[model samples]
Target: MKFVDEASIKVEAGDGGNGCVSFRRERAIPFGGPDGGDGGDGGSVFAVADPNLNTLADFRFTRVFRAQRGDNGSGANCRGASGHDVDIPMPLGSMLFDIATSEKIGELTRSGQRIKIAQGGFHGLGNVRFKSSTNRAPRRASPGSPGEQRELRVELSLMADVGLLGLPNAGKSTLLAAVSAARPKIADYPFTTLYPQPGVVAVGPFKSFVMVDVPGLIEGAAEGAGLGIRFLKHLSRTRLLLHLVDLMPPDQAPLAQQIRTIQDELRAFSSEVAQREQWLVFNKCDLIPADEIEAVVAAVLGDLDWHGRHFVISAVTRAGCEALCAQAMRWIESQAPRSEQDLMDDEISAAAAAAPDAEAGDEDHRPA
Candidate 1:
C-alpha cells in the first residue's frame, strides 16, 4: 500500500431530536394536561488510533464523515432514542488540527487511544417542562439545535527508536539493509528512497529496536528543495539520529563541506531537531586503505569540531556494523524511565536554584 502521511477531512456530529406537544383526553376525566416527551441527545464523532494501520490512505478518497442523527420525540410521553456514535479509525501517531482556525484538536500516540472531534447538538425541551400552576396546558415545544461541524487536517509521524540522516547516495539505505531486514531500493544513483521505511534490529532475544530511514536531504532542503523537506518531521519522534557520511563520493565535494551542508539544512528546518542527540558514522570505509581510515576519520572530526560518538564502517561489507548496533542498543537501554520521586527532586532543585536569582532581582528593584 502506498504510504500517506497527511489528509484533510470534514466531520459532523448528529443533531438532537425535537420535542413533542400533546394533550391527554379521556371520557372519565374532564380535562388532561400536556403529555409530551423530550428529545434524545445526538451522537458524537470520535477518532480512534489503530496500531495495525501505518498509512492514511484509507482517508484519501473518503473526505467526509458523519454520525447518526437522533430520533424525534413523540406524544403520549414517548422519548426518542439517541443516535449511534461514529468512530474513525486512524493510524498511530496521528495529530489532528482544525484547518480553519489552525488550532490543534488532539493526538493519538498510543494504541486504542481515542479523542472526540465534534460534539453533538443538544436536545430540545418538551412542552410539559414549561408547565406551571398559573398557566397550565402549555402548547410550546422547542426545536433541536444544530450539530457541530469542522474541517480537520490529520498528519502522521512514524514511531521509531532511531533515525538515519544523510545526503542522497550516502549509503543510508545500504546501512539499513545490512543491519535490518528492510529492503529499501538500492541503486548507484541518488534519491533511491522516496519515503520513510522502518525496520527492526535485534541485539538479542526479546531485545531489539526500530530504525527508520527517510529520504536523503539536500543543501536547500529546508526551503523545500528536496524530498527530505516533506519527510523530515518523521524523525521528530526518534530518540537518536545517525548521521551517515559517504567516504568516497562521485562528486569531489569536501567531506566536511558535505556534512556541513546537511547540518545547515537541518538547523534551518528545525533548530530543536538539529540540537537532538546525534552520532556521526563514516561509511564506505572499504574503499579507503585500512591504515589511512584513522587519519581520514581524525581529519574530518577535527575539521567539524565533532566531540560526540563516531563510528567507521562499510555498509556493503558489514564491517563495524555489529559494534555500532551493540553500542546503540546499550545506549538505548541506558535511557531508562525515571521514577516519580526523581522527577520531584529535579523540580525542587530547579525551583530552589531559581529562588536566589528571583530574590536578587527583587532587591535590585526595591527603593533604597
Candidate 2:
C-alpha cells in the first residue's frame, strides 16, 4: 500500500429517531391513554488506534464518516433500538485536530486507544411523557435532537529507534539496505527516496532497533523548499538521529558545509528534535582514497566539533558495518537508563579528551 501519513476527514454522529404520538386502544376499556414510546439515541463516532495499521491510506479516498441512525419509536409504548457505534481505525501515534478551530482534539499514542469525536443525538420524548395531571390527555411529542459533526485532521509520526537524515544522495537508503531487510529504491541521483522507510536492524541474535530512512533534505526545507518539512515530522518520535554524510559529495561542497546545511535544517525544523541524541555516520568511505580515510574522518570531526559517537562506513562494500552496528547497539543499550543531559555531558567529555588541542572553529572557518 502507498504510505499516507496525513489525512483530513469529516465525522458526523447519527441523528436520533423521531418520536411517535400514538394512543392506546384496549377492548372493554372505557378510556385509553397515550402509549407512544421514546425514540432511541443515535450512535456516536469514535477513533481507535490500531497497531496493525501503519498508514492512513484508508482515509485518502474516503473523506466522510458517519454512524448509524437510531430506529424510530413505535406505538404501544415500544422504544426503538439504539444505533451501533462506529469505530474509525487509525494508525498508532496519530494526532487528531479540529480543522475549524485549529485546536488539538487528542492523540492516539498506543494501540487500542480511542477518542470520541462526535456525540450522538438525544432521544426524543413521546406523547406518553406529556400525559400529566394538568392535562388528562396530551398529543404533543418532542422531536429528536440533532447529532454533532466535525471536520478533523489526522497526522501520523513514525516511532523509531534511529532516524537517518542527510542531503540528497547521501547514502541513507544504501546504509539502511545494508543493515536491514528493507529494500528501498536506490539510485545514483539525488532524492531517490521520497518517503520515510523504516526497517528493523538486528545487532544481536535477539537485539535489534528500528531505523527509519528519511528523504534527503536541502536548504530552506523548513520553510517549504523542495519536499518541505512535511516529511520531517516523521522523525520527531525517533530516539536518536544518524546523520549520514558522504565522504566526497559530487557537488564538491566542503563535507563540513554539507554537514552544516543538514544541521541547520534540523535546528530550523524543531529544536526538540535538534537536541535529540545525534551521531555522525560518514558514509561512502570506500570512495575516499584508502590512505586518506583516517585524515578525512579526523578533519571532518575537527570541523564539526562533534562530541557524540561517529562511524565511517561503506554501505556498498559493507565495510565497517559490523563494528558500526555493534557500537550503536551498545550505545542504545547503555543509554536506556541515562538521562539526556547525562548523555550529552558524557559525549562532551569524550570529545574533549580525544582532541584536547583541536579547535573546531577559528578565524579561518565558520562553525560546521
Candidate 3:
C-alpha cells in the first residue's frame, strides 16, 4: 500500500453559521420583536472515486481536509445545522490539479466519481431577516461565510489497455507475471518494476483488457531521466504499446543498438508517446541460443529495421507466451473501437511502421 502515485491536498470548505441576535422576552410577552436565527450552510469538500482505492497512500500522511462547520443560530427561531460533507476517497484514476492555477480541477475516472473540491460557506443573516416597518428594533446580525480553501494536486493515472514499453530488464515484469493477475516484482535485476503495475488480461467469455506495467524507461525518461516524468502519466491512459525488446542482451549492445536505444527514448518521451500502438515484444526468448534461434530472429529483425508485428516471447519459459497472449488479445480487440485520436493515429502508424529510419521527433511527452 505504499504506492502513492502522487498527492498534495489541502481542501477546506465549511464555515458558515453565526447569526442569532435574540430578542423575544416572556411573562406573557412584553414586546416580543425580532426572534433572530438563520445560519447554517457550510461543509462541502468532496472528491470521491474510490474503487476501493488503488493508492495515493491515503493522501500521504493525511494532508489537511476540513469541511463541517455550519450549525449556529437558535434563539427562538432556530435554523442552524448543515455542515458534514467532506467526502474525499479518491483512487480510481484521480487527476484533479489546481495547486495554484495549474487548473484542470477534475477527473476521478469512474467508480462513483463525485467532485466538488471545496465551496461551503454562506449562511449568515438573522435579526429575523431585518424585519422592517421603519426598523422594528432590528439590531442586525450576520457573520459567517468563509470556507473554500484549496491547493489540491492528486494525479494518479494507471487506467490501461496495455502499455508496457521497455528498457530496464525489458521483460515487463515477466510479461505482467505471464499474462495478468498481477504479482509484479520479478527480478533479474535492472529496476525490477518500481510502480504502476495493473493487470487484468483475459480475452474471452466476457473479454478483458487493462494491462499497464510502466516503470522502467530510461535515456532521459521524458526529461527527468530514470523514473522521472512521473512514470509518463502512466502512459497517457494507454491503448496498446507493449514494445519490450531485449532480444538477448547481457548488454553487448547491438540488438539493433538496443532497439535504437528504446526508440530514442520513445521519441524523446512523447511524440504522442512515440506514436503509440507499439507491440514488438521479443523478450528473453529463453535467452536466445537454441541454434541461435533462427539467427537471433534474423539478426534482430535485420538490425532493428523491424517491419510490422513481431513477437518471440519467453516471459520465463511461457515461450511464445500463448502466441504473445493471443496476439495481444487480437490487438486489443481491434483497437477496441478506436478513438483516442484514432488510437493515437494507430500508434503513429505503428511507430512509423516500426522505426522506418527512426527520427519522428518534435518532443512534448506531455504532462507538464
Provide backbone clash counts, one per model.
Answer: 0, 0, 1
Q: List the residue pairs that clash in candidate 3.
A: 276-347
Q: All candidates' TM-scores?
A: 0.90, 0.85, 0.42
All candidates: CA RMSD in angstroms? 7.2, 11.2, 17.8
What range of 10 consecutive residues in model 2 has the weakest lDDT sum? 355-364
Best lDDT among the predictions, by candidate number? 1
Task: List where candidate 1 sits over 4 angstroms from the true fold.
Answer: 339-368
For model 1, residues 139-215, the per-residue Cα lDDT tens digits are 99887777789999999988898999898899999999999998888986665588788889988888899999988
Better of 1 and 3 by lDDT: 1
Deviating ranges (above 4 Å) for candidate 2: 334-368
User: Could you tell me which 10 consecutive residues in candidate 1 have the lowest summed lDDT?
Assistant: 187-196
Q: Candidate 1, 212: how far from true, in Å?
A: 0.6
